[model samples]
Target: MAEFLQRVQSVVWNRKLIRTAKGHYLGLGPEKTEVGDGTDGKPVYTLVGEAYVHGKMDGEAIDFQVENQILVEKFELE
Candidate 1:
């Protein structure tokens, strides 16, 4: 991971631990939702910045949700 960081330009390390539905840890900035369309009816969330979600960084979230029959949810950030 250190080598990968070194190759990138303008990187900032910030720790804001967020827990997903399955209790997975996510290191990311807060997101906001604004009224918009073109999301195919799926609510669009405007990401404030970058994210580094462990385990679920790939397609694990989708698989987890599918296996556990978890429904998609959205929260309006204040």
Candidate 2:
């Protein structure tokens, strides 16, 4: 455990809102691929891993989206 802890680097959150047929989800992934362009002409991305944000995990993200006018985007895990 101590040896592994020494190899740790910086901690950063690359949070993103992902929308799919099932439901909306929050994830983190810095590395991604440019799949294609969306209807709005924005570049689509693919995330790698799922993340869990403590307080924002419940319905807080939804409220924030409503307040901030977050757009629904497409993301594929790779």
Candidate 1, residue 18: how far the Cα is off, in Å: 5.1
Give a tens-digit lDDT track for model 2, residues 1-78.
876665443333343433332335433333331223123454554345544544467898799989999997666655
Total clashing residue pairs per candidate? 0, 0
Candidate 2 has its poorest 10 consecutive residues by lDDT at: 29-38
Q: What does candidate 1's lDDT look like per residue over 1-78, in tens digits?
A: 888877552343343445544454644433432223124465654456655667876898799999999999767875
lDDT, residue 63, candidate 1: 99
lDDT for 29 (candidate 2)? 30
lDDT of each: 0.57, 0.48
Maximum-lDDT candidate: 1
Residue ranges of candidate 1 with Cα displaced over 4 Å = 1-5, 13-26, 30-47, 73-78
